[model samples]
Target: MNTKIEKLEHILTAFYQEKQIPAHLSAATVYSLMAGGKRIRPLLFLELLEGFDVELTPTHYLVAASLEMIHTGSLIHDDLPAMDNDDYRRGKLTNHKQFDEATAILAGDSLFFDPFYVLSNADLPVEKLVKLIQELSFASGSFGMVAGQVLDMDGEGETLSLAQIEQIHRLKTGRLLTFPFVASGIIADKSEIDLEKLREAGEAVGLAFQIRDDILDVTASFEEIGKTPGKDILEEKSTYVALLGLDGAKNQLTEKLSVAKKLLTELGITDRSDIFKMIKQLEVK
Candidate 1:
């Protein structure tokens, strides 16, 4: 897993060096791109491809880079004053704070559009390339992450039901999380049945991630989480911890993770310890 993530970082670094953009815009974009992150989404994609016994190529790394690009763009926008209004992310000043609001917006915009360029350049067949583009677009755009962001903002300061909160996360967080599995299936040419199972496992992981985040927000410190803690409570946002209580939320997270691991077992993956290692990282400290 570390090897795969290191390869992804190398690919991303080479991409920014090779591509040309406006002077300040490129700097702002690269600032956040190079900002250290867990790179979970792309790592999940690459690891799933390996689980399917697919031989990875430079093209696969390109797709993983694209996924990271989209995820980073979302974080940039999410930290804007009008959005989460965050000052720090990944333990550094956010893009809007590091640069400026306008520059951050443009930087995010460029990252969002740049993925399509990277995906188009991947060595996959035209059909697979189109599917990859369509899946990414759907996951990152209004119907997916944007929709969740909108709902999350709207639900702020309101008492939301469990179902409402789940819906928001499934759109905002789950879609992108789910993309890696579906994309891996497309690249590996898996059957529709297996693809659906992978999608389920991905969704489970996504929800588990959010739940762990909610728990961490309440329980962790600035040094622990690398960002402001208690933001959810500060914003009066509905969370698993809010509705389910810390213990209940932890139980829910455990259940979701168990479901994901079980799905992988059902898929007949041998030596899934690497993916399991990734899943284990999501657990609360």
Candidate 2:
């Protein structure tokens, strides 16, 4: 892992630990909050912001935390009896299963709201904050990640076509992954052209991440991924790996990364070379 990733973990840990807790909340909520994660989403936000010449203010930290909180919330909800029903996450017993169902739900709910609280407290101007809020709302709510999750649930046991599979992943996985990148550009006040390029990079990288996840579900052992492997196959869930062979799946991911690089080139952001390389590197799965 990169040193930056380690630093980001420290930052999120310290930030979450600093917040005062409500008496009504369960200890499981704090436990879930303390449970470690890869923090890839926040790292994505941080790396994108680093690409810019501007310094990250407290507002940026809030934005990154918002994504992390929302992600942790989603993980909690995903582990509920109604969802994946897993007993463990990140090598620890899941929040809901470890506590009561109600506690789990409330923890997830609390995690969900903290991001908005962080964002609303940003030091940026009112108009910019409003725009940021709008972007976050659309990407995280019914029109974005949530909708994708619903579709993913619906696709279980169905043999979806390649396009259908892509659509499901796009919604279920891509939206949140892309938002941090999109949001970073928004916070940086990048031009429309550059912003669009960033979106292209994010969309491609996000989709690639899902494809890699599908690949990992098959190739990785449970201990490696920290989640049960082959659940997609066990549940008969439609996935890129199910529809296409591994080689074909990687090809598609590579093609998407290519387009993402092209878009970056068009926006003149490709000059950094390594950033584009990092974006493309996700295609290896």
Candidate 3:
């Protein structure tokens, strides 16, 4: 069986190249959309799907890609002049810089709104469909990812507690991370207990992912990271590494990932051995 990442990349790249949007708009959209990253959110959803005795359908990738669309759109918006205002992402110039600010803005807007149509039109079970929308919606809404972005930007000029930083990461990053895991159970017809466990595991891994990211912002080079380093400190933002210190951050990352793996193993998912490895890899890099 294909590991979640391989299966997901094939699905996404195929879908991405197959479509033809309008020349101008499609050009802008595909440019940022195809801009590379780990595609982690969608892979998490697929890994959860693998836990069930089901076939990998084209419908699944469509749902997964929608998650990426939101993620990419958020990144585009996040890099705007009013936001992070960075010049690099995925080791390339940011969308706004590459295509011009207005084009980047519209591309981001297209990414944001286009996924709803795909999800609403997907072939998933109705129960699964509704929950998918609910999951993604929560991850994108004011109380979720956007809320985190809002706090992050708004917090820079103010004094915030460690609790506030966690709250920011939870909403901005953890919300989407948790969605794929939790929503997969709903799609796979898993029990409520399993659902809760998957959600918890997802949250743990997601939180760890952000902490690792915080550490990377300081330690990683631009060549390795694909983005400008020291932006967090430069921006004066609070992060796990800042709050916990390097050793403390690593410890928390290890603890959360261990808990996440525990839940995944307990759920009887053997196919996700790579997923476990991937989580472990996040701590060191």
Candidate 4:
């Protein structure tokens, strides 16, 4: 996974460097993009594509880079004062803190659109390219991550039911996570049933991922998680821990992990050990 992520980073760095832009904007964009992260979204996308025996192409790497750009852009925007007001992310100063708020905002806006430019220029059939772009746009747009963010802001400082929390997460975090799986299916030209199964598995893993994140917020130190701890509690935000209690949240995480693993098995994924390992790594600290 480390090697794969490094390779993706190399590709992204080269791509960004090739762009003819002002040094400051380029520096701001590269700073956020090069920040250390798990790169889980693109890793999942590429792994699933390989698992399904899709012939790897340069276009695929572009897709992977685009996913990272979108995810990073969301993080940059999320850390702004108007949003989560976070000061640090991935153990580094937030974009808005490292750069001016205006520059950070533009950097994020640039990332949001840059993926479309990559897709448009990728060497793919027009139909497939259009479909991929549409999927990405929907996942990151008003009906998807944006909607989730809006819901999260509205639900802040309010007591929310488990269903409501799930809705918020499904939109906010789950949608982008699910993108890699869905995009993989499309790239592989999988059957509708297979694609739907991938979607189900992605959704389960996404929820589990968020549950573990909520758990980490309560249990892990800032140094360990690379972000402030207890911000959820401080902001009166409803999370799995708040709604289900610590043990209950762990149980929910376990259940979602099981569901995701089962769906992967049903999809005929052989060598699910890596998936199991990832889930174990997310176990309550």
By TM-score, who's the top model here? 1
Off by over 4 Å in 4: 272-276
Model 2 is weakest, by summed lDDT over 10 consecutive residues, at 268-277
Each prediction's TM-score versus the true structure: 0.97, 0.89, 0.92, 0.95
Model 2 per-residue lDDT at 47: 66
Candidate 2 lDDT, tens digit per residue, 1-285? 365555555555565555487544636556776686766787778666766644656667778778877888888998888988888888888987787899889889987787788788879889778877887777777877788888888988999998888777777678788887788788778888888778777788778889888888888887887887888898788888888888878787788878777765665442322465467557564
lDDT of 3 by residue, 201-272 (tens): 988987988988888888889988899999988888877788788888888888889999899889887673
In the predicted model 4, the residue pairs found to clash are none
- By TM-score, rank the candidates, best first: 1, 4, 3, 2
Number of clashes recorded per candidate: 0, 0, 1, 0
Residue 280's lDDT in candidate 4: 61
Best of the two (1, 3) by TM-score:
1
Winner on lDDT (2 vs 4):
4
State the lDDT at 35 in candidate 4. 85
User: Per-residue error at 219 for model 2, in Å?
Assistant: 0.7
Question: Best by lDDT, which number?
Answer: 1
Candidate 1 clashing pairs?
none
Report the lDDT of model 3 for residue 128.
Answer: 81
lDDT of each structure? Answer: 0.89, 0.76, 0.81, 0.86
RMSD of each: 1.3, 2.6, 2.3, 1.6
